[model samples]
Target: MSKKPAGETLYVILGLLFIAVIGLRTISTPELWTHLAQGQHNAPISFLASDSAVNTTWLYDKLAYLMWSIGKAPLLILLNIVGLVGAFVLLLRVSEKWGGALSQGFALLIAGHLMFQMIDVGPEVCMMLFIALFLYLLTTQKSPAVLFGALIPLQILWTNLHGSFLFGPILAGLVAAQAAQQAKPSGGRKKNQTNLSGTLGLLAIALLVATLINPSFIKLHGQVIAGIQSPAPVYHSSLFIEYFQIPALKPLILFTMILGAGGLITLKKRLPLTLTAIAVFGAFLVWTSPYHAMLFAILSLPFIVLSLTAISEYIHSSLEQMLGGKAKLVPGIMGGVLVLLFIASIIPAATGCAY
Candidate 1:
C-alpha cells in the first residue's frame, strides 16, 4: 500500500476510534443464539435445512455461528466496528468525487451522528457497509464494463446477508442514470466520460441478474418488496426505536432535516444529479418509514455537508459585502456556538466517552 497521506490519515484514525468506542460501549446479543443451536442437527447449507427458517441469509448466519461458537457472545462488535470505519472511508471517498473537499465541520457532524447508529451491531451493520462499498466500487471503476462485473460478486453476497440488498442495484441504477446524463451523446473521439456513463445502465442490468444467484432466488426480491410494502410494519414494535413505524423520530432524521433545507436552498444552482437522486431516495425512505433512515443519513451526508458549507460561505461573504467589514466580529461569536455543538455531539465518541 502507498504511504498514508497526511490529512486523511488522522481523520481515519479518529473514525476507527469512534467506532471502537461505540462498539464496546454497548454490547447486546444479536439473534444468532437460536440459529447456532438449531443448526447443529443439520448441514450448513440452509436450502435443505428448514422450511420454517426465515433466516435464509445463511452467509451471515454462518459467520455469526462461527463467532458465537468460538466467542460465545452474540456480538460481532470488532468486525462491525472495523466495517463502520471502512464504510465511512468508502462513502467519503465516493462523496468527495462529487462534492469536492468535505469541510471538517460537516465531517464532524456526520461522524458524530453515526456514533449512535454504530452502537448496534447486527445484520444491518454489514448491510450498511456493503451499501456504501457498492456505491464506492461503482464510482471508482475506470471502465464501464468492468463496473458491472464487479457488482456481481458483491450483489450476490449482499443478497445472502440482508434483505436490503435490493437497494444495491437500485442505487447503482440511479448512479448509472446520472452517469448517462453526464455523458451526453457525441461523436467526438474524446468522449470517454460519455462512454462511461452510457455503460452504467448496462451495469445496472447485470447487477440485477447477479442478485438472482443467491439461494433465495427470485423470491428474495419479491419477498423484500412485499415486506417493505406491507401495510403493517415489517419490523416488530418491540424492536429498536427506528423500527417502530412511520412518524417516528430518530437521530438521523435531524441530519435529513438539515439536508432537506440545504438541498432546497441550493436547488437553483448546478448541484449533482446523482447526489440529488440519492437524497431523494433517502427522503422517500424516511417518509415511507423510519427504519430506513440510517440509509438516508448515509446517502445524504456529502450533499448536506457540502450544501451547508456553501451556504455558510454565502452568508459570511454576503454579510461582509453588506456591512463592509463591520460584520467581521460576527463569526467569532457564532463560531463558538457551532464549535460547542460539535464537541458536545462528536468529541465524546472520539475520546471513548460512551454516554
Candidate 2:
C-alpha cells in the first residue's frame, strides 16, 4: 500500500475527533433510552407486517431489535460504533475521489456536524452511511449500468432503514436532468441530444422501479408522502436549534453555503455540468427540509474546493504577470493559520465539557 499524504493524515485526525465526540454523546445522553422505548413499542415483526405498527422506518427498528436481542448494551454500542466509522471512511473515500486533500478535510468537518445528529440512535445514521457509499460508487465508477444495478439492492435496504431513502432516487433524477440539459445538439443531427435523452429516460425508469423492490412497496411510498405532507414536529418545536434551520447565522454553514455559491458563479466556466447539478441538489436539500442541513454541508465541500483551486490559479497567474516573478508565501501561510484557528475553535464546541 502507498503511504498516506499529509492531507489524508489531517482527514484521519479530524475523523477520529468526530468519532470521539459522537461516541461520547452516544454513551452519555438519554437519546438511547428514547430509542429503546421506541424499539419496544414498534417490535421486530412490524417490519414484515404492516406500516400501521410504527411511524418510523421498519429497517431501523429491526436493527435495534437485533442489537437488543444480544442481551447486552455493549453489543449495541459496538454496532453503532461500527456504523459511525463506516460512514467516516466512506465520506473520506468519496471526497478524495472528487477532490484531493483540502476537499477531504472539508468533508470531514462537515461529517463532524452530521455525527452530532447521528449519535442519537436514530435511523438517519444508518441512512447516512448508505448514502455515503452510494455517492462513492457514483463518483468513482465509470460504468453507469454497473453502478445503477448495484444501487438497486442498496435502495431496497435504504427504504427499510430510513424514510430519507427517497432522496436517493430524487438525487439520481436530478443528475439525469442535469446531464440532459447540458447535452449539446450534434450538427443538426441531434445525436448528442438523443443519447442524453435516452440515458436520462433509462435512469428515471430504473429509479422508479428501484423503489418497488422494497417489501413495503406502495406503503413505503405512501408513508413518505404522508410525512412530507404532515411535516415533523421537531422542526416546529426546535426552531432555535442549528439543525432545525439552514444555519444562516452559524459560521460553518454560512462558509459552506458561500463556498457552494462561489463554485457555481466561478467554476461554471469549467465544470459546468457537475457544478450546476451540485448547486441544484444542494439548494433543494437546504430549502426542503431542515433535517438535510448536514447533507448540504457534506456534499458542498468538493465543489467548494474545486472553486477555490480555480480562484487560486487565477490569482497566481495574475500575480506572476504583475511581479514578473514568484510572489511571497504570506497569503498561503495566513490562510493555513486561519484554518488552524477555525478548527481549534470548532472542535472544542463540538466536544462539550460533558463529554
Candidate 3:
C-alpha cells in the first residue's frame, strides 16, 4: 500500500480544525436549547394527539425528543459533531477519488466552510450527508437501480428532517437528465438512461409519499412550500451578510464562482458527465440560495483541483519543451506558492475573523 503524503496530513488537520470551529458554535449556541425545550415539552401523548395539525416533521421531532430525554446538551452536541465529521469524511473520500492530494485538501477546506455555516441543528446537515452519500453512490456504482434504491430511505429521512427534501429530487433529476442526454447512441444507452430516469423519478415519488407518512400529511408539504416561498426576515434586517443575499457579489463568492467556471471551461472534455452534473447542480443551488454557497464550494473544489493539476501538468510539459527540462522546479515552486496563498486567504486568522 502507498503511504499518505505530507500534504494529505495537512488536509486532515485542516479538516479537524473545521470541525472544531463548527463544534464550538454548536455547543455554544442557545438555539439548540430552545429546540430541545420545544421538542421535550411536546413529548406527551396528549400533545401529539391534540396538536397533530401543527406538528410538521413529527419524525424529526421525535428524534429530537429522544435526544432531549437522554442528555439534551450532550446528545445534540454529539449528533452535530458526528454529522460534521461524517460530512468531512465523505467529502475527503469523494475528492480523493476524483483528484488526489490537492483535491482532498480543497475538499477539506470547502467542507470546513460548510461546517462554519452552522447547519448542525437543522435538517440541512442531514441533507448534506445524504447528498454526499448520493454523490458517492452515483460516482462509484455502475448500476443505477442500486443507487436509486439506496437513495430512497435518504430521501424519506430528508423529507422528515427538512423541507429541503425537494433538493434531493431536483439534484437527482438534474443528474439523471444530464446522464440521459449524454447517453451513447447504442440501444443499451437508451435502456440505461430510461432506467436511471425512472428510478430517480420513483425515488422522488416515494420521498413525497414518505413526507405524507407523518401525521400532518399534505399540510406538512404545504408548510414546507410556504416556508420556501416566504421572504426571510434577514433579507430585510440590517445584517447584510453576503450569504443572505439573493445574488451575492461578495469577493469570496465571486472567486468560487469563477473557480467553478474555470474548472468547467478547462476540463469540460476530460471530466465525467456525473461530475459535471454535480458541479452544475451545485452551481444552480448556489444561484438559488446563498445558503448553498458552501455546497458550491465543496462541489467545485475537486473540479478546481483537477483543473489546476491539468494546468500544472500542461505548464510543466510546455516549459520542458521551452527550457529542455531545466525549468521543472519553477512550475513546482509556483504551484506551491499559489496553493499557500489560497490556503492563507481562506483560513480565518482568529475566531472573531470568521464573520
Q: Best-fitting candidate, measured by TM-score?
A: 1
- 7 in model 3: Cα distance from truth in Å? 3.8
List runs of model 1 lying over 4 Å from the truth: 1-16, 29-56, 72-75, 98-119, 185-191, 231-255, 267-269, 322-342, 346-355
lDDT comparing candidate 3 with the true structure: 0.59
TM-score of each: 0.76, 0.73, 0.74
lDDT of 1 by residue, 1-114 (tens): 366455445444454454445555345444544445434543443456454434445677677668766775535566766776677677777766434332433554554464
How many residue-pair clashes does candidate 1 contain?
0
Q: Which lDDT values do the candidates have, in the order given? A: 0.63, 0.59, 0.59
Provide C-alpha RMSD values for all models, in order.
5.2, 5.3, 5.2
Best by lDDT: 1
Look at candidate 3 and give me any clashing residue pairs: none
RMSD of 2: 5.3
lDDT (10s digit) by residue, model 2, range 1-355: 4777664566556645556455543444455555665567754434465534334465576567668877557667667667766766765665553455544555555546643543455565676677667666655554667766777778777877777777667656655665566666657436665565566557656766777766666877787888778765434344455654433324555565666666556553556454446546765765565456555644554565565555555565778778754455634553465358447745675656422
Superposed by TM-score, candidate 1 places the C-alpha of residue 5 at a distance from the truth, in angstroms, of 11
Candidate 1 TM-score over all chains jointly? 0.76
* Collision count for each candidate, in order: 0, 0, 0
